[model samples]
Target: MIRFEDVSVTYDAAPGPTVQRVDLIVPEGELVLLVGPSGVGKSTLLGTVSGLVPHFTGGTLRGRVTVAGRDTRTHKPRELADVVGTVGQDPLSHFVTDTVEDELAYGMESLGLAPDVMRRRVEETLDLLGLADLRDRPIATLSGGQQQRVAIGSVLTPHPQVLVLDEPTSALDPAAAEEVLAVLQRLVHDLGTTVLMAEHRLERVVQYADQVLLLAAPGEAPVLGDPAALMARSPVFPPVVALGRIAGWSPLPLTVRDARRRAGALRERLAGAEPRRATPTEPTPAPGTGRRWAGLRRERTAEALPGVVAASVARLAVRRGRVEALRRVDLTVTPGETVALMGRNGAGKSTLLSTLVGLLEPASGTVRVGGAVPHRTSPRELIRHVGLVPQEPRDLLYADTVAAECAAADHDADAPPGTCRALVDELLPGIADDTHPRDLSEGQRLTLALAIVLTTRPPLLLLDEPTRGLDYAAKTRLVTILRGLAADGHAILLATHDVELAAEIAHRVVILADGEVVADGPTEQIVVSSPSFAPQVTKILAPQEWLTVSEVRRALDAGGGEPW
Candidate 1:
């Protein structure tokens, strides 16, 4: 149904083609997964399907691209709307209406469908995506994951023959992600629809793909083949595949079940050795004192109380309009601790982060950071106590160029010039200073926002969905940087749905359900018990306490031999 013939794309002032000589055919009624590292033109290649590359994005296409027998060169995005439905990484940009129901119906209305037909399709999509409860809620009031579902439902209501998605499940929780993927599976199997998806979180979707298309690097020819064959040599892959490689499996396993089937001996080898646990980087806080260490001391009068808890929330309640987003939530963080806040979509994870960062005022209860109330603290003074990297990275960026943004961060934090730039280089390398923030990919933008926040050097750091678009390599770099920060006596609280990330970095995991704390404990105890929250490694090595690939590697190295 989709064909690319000798395709190559280059921008107005680029040195070479972003995607060079990409030729492939995706059969009808099949799901094709596009896999590659960030900036290797995964998004650029997807844009060619709907004619968004050369036509809408102001680039040059060297060869022909066709979808459903129509050449994209002749058909603009609007012209192909009847057959192609595209959802980019940013769902907020895809929205046109304010309410969930209206957004879902907007696509059919644009197609000039009858009112009855549009209404029926809208209701069907709401049920399919589990958005029935949120149908009446305004899009602005919904959480990030909720917005992602709405965005997907909007495109799905039109009943197009072909669907193109970028990072479709990046924002969704484990359960919600499963629901959405099951719906896509039904579309491919029962309805004979063609799907071309690009995602960074391979663990969630690799097992479902009918075929895999790999773009190894920029200006390199693309490879299309079976999922297992390509995954064996692919540079970026999920944790399960990495574990399979480490154990030297003949055919790499793509799902947890396959890995578990082969993990018996490896688990036995690890039965005697326990995985290393994440501990506090700084000295533990005094017993029952509720006061953190004075590792990052700043002189203050008696009123300032420089030595205090990194973050303390007691009997906290927050309301958005009439909805109680958070209810009587009590939590505390000390210096040199890493805590992960996890929950399903609209379960009040983001709401809690907002309250802590002073973006939302608590309806009732107390919120103190470094002995000062966040809501009452000035923006200037709050920077000294805590820093936040919001879900939407664009919210923290305002400058026209990357260099200007870095300079702005340095000035705001009172740090020396180039401090933010250095952090950016370490997190995501090779980004030119002259590039506009809008010109960057989603992963790059998230990294830049993180670097800017790190410049402030606050005692407490808050990250919301920090790994939304990062590939495995970039995520590893991020894990290294975050670990170093924790060792330097910085308390970190990150709100994320990436279970793998939590397993790799979090010392403790706190789960919230229906705006209340459901469970909180050591990382291994909390994640290993919950089937929904466990990482691939933990699931594969069940009955064992392993949480990540690094842990298994370390155990084997210390023992000095492979199980097989």
Candidate 2:
């Protein structure tokens, strides 16, 4: 269905060719997963499949590319629309119509399908993607995850032969991700639709992939093979793969069920062992790097941090148009505490974050951060008490360069001039100072926004899907920074779908459903008990309380049992 013959693409401002000599064949009805670190040209490669690489993105494509036996070099995006459906990372940029129903039918209408056929396809897509109840709603009024579904539904109605999605489930909750994955599975099995996806959260999609494409680095040819064989040595992988490596399991498992079958001896070894005690301290850079940075120690203790309340909410309710996004939710977080907010898509997780940060005023009830009401506080006062890193990280960035952004942040926070710069170094190492903000990758942009927020040293920090596009190394750096903040009496709240992240850093867990808090408690008690919310390690070692691979690795290192 898709073929790339010695394809090499270069951009005007890039240091080198974004992708070099990429040759691959994606058979019909197969799901190919594209895995790589940030800024390694996954998006650039996907654009080539849709004839958007040099055609629409103003880059240079040097080799032959074909989809459905039609040469993309000669065909424009519009010409390939019937066979290729491409959904990029930013869903908000893909919309034209106002309502969900119209958006789904627009593509079919463009293809000049009969009115009756368009109507039938629209209804089928609405039910296929679980968007029936939202058909009449305005696209702009929907949450980020809801908008993502609308964007995907809009393209699926075209019945394209191949689907190319960039982080399709990044904004969704665990169950919602499962739903979308299930639909993709159906499309591949029942309809013989080919799929190509690029996702940062490997834990959610790795098991469903038919083959793996690992772009080791920029200007390097991709390695394509079986998923397990590739992930065994790949730096970027899920917790389940990590656990298999630690246990020395042959033919490593891709799913929890596969791991669980081979986990008997591994479980026995860790039965009597306990996780190591973590030494929480600030990170120091290599030899003579001059400044301290945030780095993670990985062995985060399971015990909750105790301190005074940093934020509190009582009977908070939020509404959007006719949708009650959040119910009468009551919540609280204390200093030195890290809490994770989790739920299905459009289940009110974003609404809760918006309410806490003053973006959405609750229709009823109250929200207080550091003893100050968020809705009533001035900008200066609010900056001191609370800071938020939004889902769309660009929302917090407008400066032309990284240096200017740091300088402005330092002036606003009244901190030393180099404070924000050091934080940026800690979050995203080796990023050039003179580079334009728009030129940075999605993950780097988020890191910069996070650094800006951290420079303020706000007592209450809130992040929405903070690890959306980060690789393992970058995510580890983020883990260290967040753990340092929690240790220093900063109350941190994260809204995320990455179960592995919640497993490693969060001390408490709160699950929301239909705008109401369905479950709230310690991280282990909450996540390990739920099938959908459990992390990879917890799923493999079920009936036990294990939550992360690091914990088990620590136990094994402490003489849990002999290795196989």
Off-target runs (Cα >4 Å) in candidate 2 are 276-307
Q: Write the per-residue lDDT of candidate 1 for residues 1-564, one digit (tens) a residue.
A: 999999999987778898998888999999999999999999999999988987889889988899999999989999999999999999999999999999999999999999999989998999999999999999999999999999999999999999999999999999999999999999999999999999999999999999999998888898999999999989999999999999999699999999899988898888899786667545232232222212222232123334546899999999999799999899998777899999999989999988888999999999999877998999999888889999899999899999999999988887778888988887888888988999899999999999999888888899999999999999988887777667657788999999999999898899999899999888889999999999999999988878999989988999997776
Off-target runs (Cα >4 Å) in candidate 1 are 281-308
Candidate 2: 10-residue stretch with minimal lDDT = 296-305
Model 2 earns a TM-score of: 0.93
Candidate 1's C-alpha lDDT? 0.89
- Highest TM-score among the candidates is held by which one? 1
Model 1 lDDT-worst window of ten: 288-297
In model 1, how large is the Cα lDDT of residue 195?
A: 94
Candidates' TM-scores? 0.96, 0.93
**lDDT against the true structure, each candidate:** 0.89, 0.84
